[model samples]
Target chain A: MSAPPNRPVFAGLTSAYPRSEELVRATRDLDRGRAGAGAVETLYAASEKEVAALEERLFTTITGGYLRWNDLFRPIAESWTGFSVGPLTRWLETNTFFRQPVLAQPPVRVPGTVAARLPPVLGQRPEKARVLLPGPYTLARVLDNRTGESDGAVVARLGALYAEELAELRALGFGTFQFTDPYLVREPPDGVLETATLDAYRTIDAARGSSTTIVWTYGADPTPALRTLDRLPASVIGIDLTEVEAASLPAGPEGVGLGLGIIDPRTTLPENPVETVKVVREAVRRRRPSSVWLGPAASLDLLPTKPAEQKLLRLADILQALRREGVA
Target chain B: MTDALFPTQEIGSLAKPSLEELRAWQEKVPFVDRLGPSGPDLLRGDAPEALPDLRAAFAIAFLESAGLDRVYDGEARRIEMYEHPIRQMAGFQFLGHVRSWDSKYYRKATVVEPVRLVRPYHLDEFDFVRDHARRGVKLPITGPYTLADWSFNEYYLARQPGWRGRPQRWAAQREFVVDLARQALRPTLKALVDRGCRTIQIDEPAAGTHPDEAALVVEGFNEATAGIDAEFSMHICYSRYEALLPALLEAKACRQWAWEFANRDSGDHDPYAVLRTLREYGDTRSIGLGVVDVHRDPVERPEQVADRIRRAASYLGDPTRIWTNPDCGLRTRRLDVAYDKLRAVVAGSRLARAEFASSRR
Candidate 1:
């Protein structure tokens, strides 16, 4: 199954593809003195080979130029969250984990922060590289806020720091950025914090200049926060439709794009392609979004690598089926 | 200053491997850089105690070197908080793997048969610490409620005679927990007490995670410690303490409370915000203040920790009801980092102890 001729549907990871447990086990062997460090490289190289194969099977030409850069994993963000990123923090209400980016002082852009540490492959499709980073407000929420500043102060500081990092990524040739903020959806801002959070996103968006910014929210429904998020001047808004009924999605802003995450990364159960199409069609029909994309409801990192891989394969088949139906 | 605040005990887990302990594999795998050297060995059971003790010795050494007033074997004998207990309990099988935060997975177990203790789990480790410890050692037992909360209840649920509804499910869950409390926690506490163990901390992280089950948590604690005499504690973190409160007041008599504070200390978020409820309740339960952070490996300044103790004391309106500790376990850190952080915990505790004692006089 494939898209309509000359159709423009894009299929890609909204966040980092999972690092396989085999690679982790191999790395563990290196750590335990049972194997040489080169073993890790060998295994990781093989893992990347599989990732390349999956990308080949699933992604479309509209997304062909954005393979390796399309999904910058947690290591990049954790290692470069401008502070000594803390130990892996558990995602509340779920079984998944993330190495929390500690906000000791304001997060800053040091000389070699993330952008400088890019693998050689990141440069190949530099023009269309889609880089993922924690959004300013989300980053602030997870931070070990060392300063006794107000939430607004923390948000502004984080927004400025994220701006600096995004600007650096932009300078390094990354054009599309997905700033993830799951907190906004899980607990929409009320009263004064809402205004501050909105202002903070505006500051971050302004700093990116011409680069595309897709502010993504997961872990909760985005319906209530839609109005506030729409005013941020970002190019796109990514919604997690896993929890909310597709019928409940609001008719959104005219110019901003909408990406509906229809795939469930938590389980290996095959998603019905027909039902998925209906969800997408309804979102498009109701929201009248300027542009639309299909992806998973949240970071695929939450799943074990096997389930994540299966979900990706399933997603690929569904997209292929959608394409065969000539419904881009 | 409301009375005695002299002792400082570590919350549990002192696992920090030095860089030298890591294998000679580097300069290769780009992704391998994220994992610390405390990798595979972290999931296994007690390596036969090397010399005086294997993993326990290093932990005791650090706490001792830091000059803590109380200590433990640092939970070096166990793999992690959940499975270590589940492994020793009969009728539970390794069901599958579950994430222990992120990336890291713990072997999740389920009871396919009736629950029973294969043997006393904590005594051997406790004996080692008891022999070598310079101060009082606290043995941390994973609480009955947490053991029930974390595990899948195959054993109890299957035996229910009819259609399993919400109430039946709840009954099955409670039966499994209380059964474990009778078979595991109570017996363990009795054995430890019989061995002259004076302080036992029942870790109930799951209690705080699910507040709706607070009563069961308290029930587990009460049943586990009934007729058994010791300085007991209920340790919890990353929870909504509000839900546990009022109810937590009931169980405070059986044991003092040890909680994580520093890691949750978000500037204006005020880590000590819960002390108000504690103060309002007027039950003078000793509060274990987590002065050191376990979330990050960064060693805090000694003064930073001292300031935290002072702040906790001030808010509780009583200087004497406080104890200094790390926010949680130190298992994820590098060895040197854990040592340095504990040193900070000790130093900071000393500074605050002197100031607090003097201020009261």
Candidate 2:
């Protein structure tokens, strides 16, 4: 039986964007004591505006570009209780590194930490904004868990903290939240991860009132956790098409949306829009998702400014081709 | 092996030279002007010929003054470990900077064609160090596996277009790494050995990046140092050392394993837990035991360093099998910090030696 065709929406970057040359210079200057805090802020604001304008042109959902964030966990690590920034650790197989969060005690969310870190432009169009966060599973896996809690318990606690943050963000008019879980696919799926993942998402789902919740997994193959992932409480389940073929994507739960990671963000080579649309069509046909979001397979921070921008433009081109073909 | 118990050596790299320091060395070293313009700044693309040699002289003097048993030029002649070697090789073009961690960026390159060594990248630097240094020298070269892992492989991926999966990528990576070992690193190692450089440390921080491909590390090492007659050691830092144990044990050419344990475990609680694990896996190779943390600013007391050596000694069952050093390259630390850390290592080794003598009595 042929699966029904579904129209897909464009979701811009679900993680940090590569810093522009000017922003990079400003950051270095700030680090070297040549530039003041205000000067750096000015540059960040300008970059944030440019990013917002670019996303407004191409995306159905927009982000603040995460220009100020050093890494995915930096903001939380700096502001949250019981966590401190530790030594540099490799982020999966990539050359990039993140300061691992050292948890001394149970994690507790500090009020307004997320909002303060976010670009002010996000507040103006909260209805269209999407906030990217590190998923509980990934956090529990990456952090130096010194709280003496089991991995499962740590995941649950982090999920509860995120749940509170989500409730607050939802009240602030944010429309979508993407929780990236690279660790889920990197490590083998066990009973502990499966149970903890479900429980954590359940907590996040309960707190997120009317806002879209997405659980996006990348960096490694997500095939092993497909069964557990299909049953996630999130509104959308994202899979890296670069890692798994489009045809191999199993059917998702009824009424669940799908985030199709069709573009490869790690490489500088430009992807063909026609070929990308074909992959999206195949994934939609197999998964039979209620809705879809087209995006990069992972974070765009690994690439340079020119290549990252080109990747986004390619995504815009793919969307246009999809529209012409009556797929979206 | 040195006659001294708990012989100390530098891991690699001292702090980078300041502009004033470079100028001072240029004035002092008479041959600096005759060396001609070389060593292109990877980021800016300007050749500063005399600067590198002068920098090497400056670093060698520092290490010798610190009283280390084995010392190199502190990698002062190069831009960094990755870019310096890649810039000297063929078929690579530098892309923009990529962040390694907070506020730190390394110039990354892509393999556009089959890579080959243009010349022995470290020979000039080694020659300068040999002329200037009073202490025994161990030249640290970036290993073939690390070079392959750090680079983006455009050439090999293009070779097999049909095999499109993780397995295919892995296959391409293996081919790229092996080719590097044979084509690039082997010739380089041979030239260094021919130059009367006895001890060569192959720095492979990326050795444990892929646990499944641990065999590739062994294969690369063996291929690079295949016919070269020299004492070879493998230096791997800030990695999953346990994952590479089986392959590490198989790497017969690597007589010593210079690994970083101080940064993670300082012998405070679970004293040298990873060392215990390595020994349990039947590892019998000499260890370059890291006693001081390079990332931290506070200097470790000599007694604290002795305690770390003592704990590692307990696991190895032989003090002679242990060599004292800082966790990794002191390039990350300040100049004063690196100097103090090195002094601590030297002092700590001496303390450990005295304690061992007393126990025997």
Q: In lDDT terms, which candidate is top?
A: 2
lDDT (Cα atoms) of all candidates against the true structure:
0.67, 0.79
Candidate 2's fnat?
A: 0.26
lDDT of 1 at B231: 88
* lDDT (Cα, tens digit) per residue for candidate 2, span B115-230: 88798778877887777677888999998888987777767866755423456567777888888898889998888888889999999888766666778888899999997889
TM-score, every prediction: 0.69, 0.91
Q: Clashing pairs in model 2?
A: none
Tens digits of per-residue lDDT for model 2 on A77-160? 999999998776667655677887888899899999988888788988999888888999988888888887888999999889
- Candidate 1 chain A weakest lDDT stretch, 10 residues: A61-70
Candidate 2 chain A minimal-lDDT segment of 10 residues? A1-10
Task: Indicate the residue-level lDDT of A275 in model 1.
Answer: 67
lDDT of 1 at B121: 82
